[model samples]
Target: MDEEYDVIVLGTGLKECILSGLLSVDGLKVLHMDRNDYYGGESTSLNLVQLWKKFRGSDKPPPQLGSSRDYNVDMIPKFMMANGTLVRVLIHTDVTKYLSFKAVDGSYVFNKGKIHKVPATDMEALKSPLMGIFEKRRARKFFIFVQDYDESDPRTHDGMDLTRVTTRQLIVKYGLDDNTVDFIGHALALHRDDHYLDEPALDTVKRMKLYAESLARFQGGSPYIYPLYGLGELPQAFARLSAVYGGTYMLNKPECKVEFDEEGKVCGVTSEGETARCKKVVCDPSYLPNKVRKVGKVARAICIMSHPIPNTNDSHSVQVILPQKQLGRRSDMYLFCCSYAHCVAPKGKFIAFVSTEAETDQPETELKPGIDLLGPIDEIFFDVYDRYEPVNEPSLDNCFISTSYDPTTHFESTVIDVLNMYNMITGKVVDLSVDLSAASAAEE
Candidate 1:
């Protein structure tokens, strides 16, 4: 096997497959392989039998659960923001033609002890019950500042340069309370933690703008969207794109052993006694444990339900973020729900996931705040997996490794990881600027 490739991707995860597709479209020859027979490695959707087999092990699924083929439960649950980076990538690569998307119905945040719809726009801010009458006025002013904010428009700056101001300082400038700042920073801005308070306001403002723009795109109750079936559709769609661009894919290839050159750089990958020569390799952290370090742990609980999550306004699908401060924790907890409405489950069945960054050995205890919100569940399964990040620089070894998925319900953090890796590999940043007309066409 003397065939040489510009890049070799050793896993079928979403990140690797997306990279392969983008590189192939850029005219780089790519060889994509996965040890598993499926397209998604860590991020796959499983049917009832497969799902039960994975979690329950050897035990047969209950007959009352209906047809096994009717279920498509994602191992790692996450949704895409319609106008977010992932959607932009789909439109940029024309991958939307391979998939269908439905807007999520709700986005809620936990405050004190109740769930409230995140008020983003000024109108919502004015009517929001989360704040007192006086507080609503202050929040409305803050929302106005954010909505009118334009980096290039001095008229919209309001005498405070967001680039030079900390997010905490900007919040104080608007006279926002701690509770208002909590949801604004965690729910609307989608920050993982309150750590962004000390960071520049520019980042938080940009994130808030993205949420608003995405919400305006569909005029839906929420800013996020999910593909029909499940997230597993994403990797396969990208795989199709890579194939159309002349990239090769091999699945069920056993023992994918990576080879290193004398200079300690990736030279090729060996599988089934044949070596596929390539200049560089990209893969998930699992494929190269030695090159990765355990960063943290994610504890998640997957539940099957007969109805929508309580207090979500009966939304067919929803995302609920519980800010750390509300739960007296150091990180946010995510609640994601989808069901027959999204074609991922049987009729009248709903799937909900509660996940958070694990701080102790007890995951169920750590995620209790989120799980308590689900009134009743038919079946529930809990899982905890370690998170990993690469310790080596891609420029040094030519071996690029993707980090483990975080405990996020949205794709914003995931896409950021992908874009950073793309820049590292190509030595150029992928411009995220979108042409309004093009985005509209894709939506149509």
Candidate 2:
């Protein structure tokens, strides 16, 4: 099949899907391919049920038992696939487990147990035990101030500003109470790294402001726009959109060589025994260009699924548990997603993604238990584990543990860059499912 096209996209990531769609919509012939056998690359969904049955057992309650009916996973796959979406399931656990928390004074409280059912505002979040009193007030004030700005204003300025300041700096500058600072710090650490608190203050503020604005714009928006079935649903949407626009997708076929012209422009790519030619080529992988230039780095992530959602009131959304300390050297970061969407887990289960940034040469056994950036696990997990047995004793049978890595750039940063590249190549702004419209509107 010696066919030529107007453009050739090398990867099947969200950005690749978007570019392929945009180009094809313009009546351009496009060929899209990936070295992997499945679409959505890192975001591809595995069969959680099959994975659970293979690793744990076939007769366990589903992972998303307590979640709302609208967000349940039971029929999400069929619904999404019929609507031209693809989903990959990553089975981490058979049930949702909550980390029980004890106050400094020694009162045991289930973090993910009873529903708080408070107002969805930042103020309401502040009032909850999820954070300290002082921290809640400061966060409320900060969010209120941010909601006042328009993100889409042309004069809104670019790059880091006061709105983007790190949480640590925000706390310090505002003279917030230590407990409040600690809570906010822990929250940020849970999402990224403890060192993330050391990030540019403006960047932190901007991100917080964005979240605040998003909350304000959509009522109960936090639970409204979950990743439909599994996190993989996000990429699946892009994949389906790409296919509808006449782009070809292939997976498991690794690119053996990138054919470049003498002028250094990408001409086409080849994988296995097949060679495809095109005018433009795009590459977005996990390894940083600098690292790939030298020894190359690969990111490792571990998904942990346990019984009963741990430590929180809401079963619909993932609860981020942050570490207390700031100084540490670990590579893995922990993120818990309640399989409120049943596709990934059976009823009554939750999955947690414990990811670490490590070198490709590092052994799986040697990799730390969790991301080091969050600091010591004992400090964060000891109390919670003691109070609530998040993990089942001796572990459940179907708990599946899988590892994945990329040789391009960090997942979060690379994803955004891919979107930007899509905009650059296709001359159109990429629409991220998570509404950045508030940020855009503020800039305007």
Candidate 3:
């Protein structure tokens, strides 16, 4: 193996993959290393069936159940462990199979009546149950303001820009009704409840609008693609593509100490009791600055897969459920289905994700109320899967549930940290991803 390279990337996350792949393509010798044995930092998929068998029991034929041939037999999605070190198997289906929507009264809507696919206009979308009335009004007004802004516009808003506003401000500014404000606030809380309560209303509005625009772009243009096989395929693709371009990927090598020369330039890195020399080093590991301290903050998510996908049809692709007073404060919960893609699950099985933000020290038991499966479960499932009859004594076989902790650092900030460090030394925007950041943060 070569003792030195032009660039050494120290993480295998998405950013690291992009940097390594691009540099290798540009004719620079690059080496990418990950402390873990597998790739795909956060977005990797797991083998769900295998995981279910390991955690619960092996798959067996159901008595009086439909023929085995009717069931979709395939490897389930994989997941990263709670601490982000190990990758394990999950249930074999995608989230759509278990998802259903209902009105506040717990009445189930039929599949045909689940989602009201209205026009893309703001007013029509607001009228749809995808958002609450107040939220719809706020979104309608906000969309009107940025309706003409394109990606090339100098004042285009991004996540940081949106962080400055609040949901209250957006509602008031738009003269939205109290009910509408509550709904919009609830939706925002659901999507970003972790940070929404304290975030500026103006920033929240901007960010939501940005996301809406991005969705619109994807709907009309080439959609952003996730890996077909699994999320793991993404990192593997980068590793394979990197190798094809003369880049090296060293797995299970954890960088212990970063060595810098007297001039403050990163000259080399020591990992797994061995040192590697490089002219430039990029750290792509999750929680860069934050990792230097403790394990970092993370959340717990459970993916439930049901057999013989229930016939529930909800118009919305995702559902946000705010906890009641009895559910305890700080217990934020959300549910979403895999609707954009079908390859994620087998033909007869669908998948759904139930997630809650948890503290690192708390036990999963403390978050049990958030995981209760009985409340509104039947109504929601019936709404989405009305055609199919649920097994008389429905058994949740081979389901997958696991927790993932997100690094305390934001994705955007991490990118900026890398680009700014490189720019200070190289005096240029070395990465296109870096170029995408606003100039305030991009410029050194």
TM-scores, all models, native as reference: 0.98, 0.59, 0.57
Global fold similarity of model 1 (TM-score): 0.98
Give all candidates' CA lDDT scores: 0.90, 0.40, 0.40
Off by over 4 Å in 2: 48-122, 130-140, 149-170, 182-202, 216-224, 250-256, 271-274, 284-306, 314-317, 323-332, 358-414, 423-444
CA error at residue 211 for candidate 3, angstroms: 2.9
Q: Check candidate 1 and list the clashing pairs.
A: none
Which is the better candidate, 1 or 2, if ranked by TM-score? 1
- Candidate 3: which stretches are off by over 4 Å? 25-27, 41-43, 49-121, 129-167, 177-179, 182-191, 194-202, 217-225, 252-266, 270-274, 284-291, 307-328, 339-341, 360-370, 373-444
lDDT by residue (tens digit), candidate 2, 1-444: 157766666556554554565566667787777667656654445564433443456635254433333232211111111001111110111001111111010111112322222223466656666556666676676545544534566344323255456656656655666544443433322234457666655555444454333334334323113333554554455555556667676666665355656865556667776677766655443311211222223333333243433433334344333332321434323333445344455454454333333433453432343333223221111100000111211122111111123221113333444445555555666333432332221110
Residue-level lDDT tens digits of model 1 in 1-444? 469998999889889988998898889999999999998999999999988888889558999888888888998999888789988888788888888888889999999999999999999998888999999999988888899999999999899887789999998888899999999999999999888999889999999999998889888899988988898999999999999999998999998899999999999999889998989999999889899999999999999999999999999899999999999999999999999989899999999999999999999788889999999999999999999999997887999899999999998888889998888889977766755335453332
